[model samples]
Target: MDTASTNHSPHLHVLHDVLTAATYEASSAMSVWTGGKISLTLDCVREVPLESISEEFDLGMEPLTMVVLTIDGDAGGTMILTFDEENGRGLAASLFKQEVSTDPEWTETEKSALMETGNILGCAYFNAIARLVQAEFVPSPPAFLQDYGPCVLEQALMLQAQCSYDVLICQTTFLKGEEKLNWHILFIPNPKIGDALQSAQ
Candidate 1:
């Protein structure tokens, strides 16, 4: 496979359209909630080598909360969305209007909100693709990780290992008020799906 050229797969165009729609939706939602406008930037989407995925984990510490949405295809890979604990808490506090104390009892609520927020954003993106491709796609229930450290990477690695050497990574940034939130969306296509995408071009 020509990895270099595949990096710019046509699927990226579809991905971009979905991201644009999602950004609009995210901005509208945030504006209504915060009384401030929100904007989003599409950072990048590319084919990432497996080794690099491991390196990213080594550089970052966990007790990270990540959400994974799996796509079933011959090219199966995990899509992960990551956020900082402090940022996550801040957003939750702003939305709920309650102090998000570090109490374990309230952890569930915090986790739920995080997952729900991701779902809304993901749906906006995924729904766009579904419309463009004229196919129905369903994302799995989100999986949450509260532990900080290499464990976060472990989960990602486990998910990636089920597929090939390359996975599509989509990076996005959301700005609300003066704060910026980073979102990373991975598209791991199984062998067949990957070949399909590659063949389309």
Candidate 2:
């Protein structure tokens, strides 16, 4: 295998492990908040190409927001988590219980709840990664976005060009109240980070 492929393999495994742990953490957090069970299906983490999204959802329907959360690494790349609006709202609702509507009118408590939940989920993901890699990683404050398509693509391109590697996409699902929603997390390691992992063996 070439350098790129070789580097991608182990990182993907690391991402997979982190994602699996994150799924369990997210489900546990939701269960605690809602007093309901949360289960993740295997199909959740399977990566889907960007083109396949059209077949996944109805077009011409209300465009859902895709929120991307990225953690910039000291080595030069970033780790990102993206979520569709439906799943985002569902997660927000699951954590907050009230203020589940898609309205901009958010109470102070609702805002705090959303931020707290995002922090918790993001921390769980990175903590698993830190354990697997045996390195300390600190994530910046979480950021939110109300745009998708070109906007998301542009942001991803910026991160990729800076790191010179394609992002590893991990899809996640949160099930609650007879509802199943999907979210995505992208593991974009910096070139140096990739090189370190490749050279480890």
Candidate 3:
């Protein structure tokens, strides 16, 4: 029997528990903003070789609206919130208290609405992660982009690839009412934060 392998399970379980709570907190905040109960479904949480992304990953063909933000201060890294056409417009309309149809092109007002949603949602998620680790995490002003998913994500992942080949990523999907919203949030934790998570155990 491998005693070391058995002992490692508890630490992994603890970390997963903490992370799950933080993610739920984030989803709750977003639900409030949307004036609806939005649920988040965790798609994947794992560490992957950065190099494999270019060769193996497909971010699908849907047009995406994305927000990219940097985490500064005690912990440094990046966060990205993405929405497909349906979710982006739906959310923007909710924020404006209006109805939005699925439009391939977004208006300036629509863009601003999505940007604001990103700012608020990104901060909520960052705060949760920061609290879990007891570290100060500040988010920079978000940059908005509307493009294909892979293209937009590639730009953000470029920075991570520079520093580490293996990165921790959590992908989640958001749902509004009975309809599933094409919303995704992907987080890349700083190396320092990764060390802190391990040391906390």
Give one digit per residue, the lDDT tens place, for model 1 in 48-101: 776676564342654555666665544344456676677667666766778867
Give the clash count for model 1.
12
lDDT by residue for model 2 (1-201), tens: 001112336655544555566667766765665566554432233333445533542322444344344556643334344455666666667665655676865455544555565666667666665665567777776555555444454455454456443443444544545676555444444445545444433
Which candidate has the highest lDDT of all?
A: 3
Q: What is the lDDT of residue 141 in candidate 1?
A: 76
* Candidate 1 residue runs with Cα over 4 Å from true position: 1-7, 30-38, 55-59, 74-78, 148-163, 182-201
- How does each model score on lDDT? 0.57, 0.51, 0.67
Determine the C-alpha RMSD for candidate 1 after optimal superposition of all C-alphas.
5.0
Worst 10 residues of 3 by lDDT: 1-10
- Residue 199 C-alpha lDDT in model 1: 46
Per-residue alpha-carbon lDDT of candidate 3 for residues 148-198, written as tens digits (9 for 90 to 100): 877766666666677788655666667766666667777666655656666
TM-score, cand. 3 vs. native: 0.79
Score every model by TM-score: 0.72, 0.65, 0.79
Measured with C-alpha atoms, the lDDT of residue 148 in candidate 1 is 57
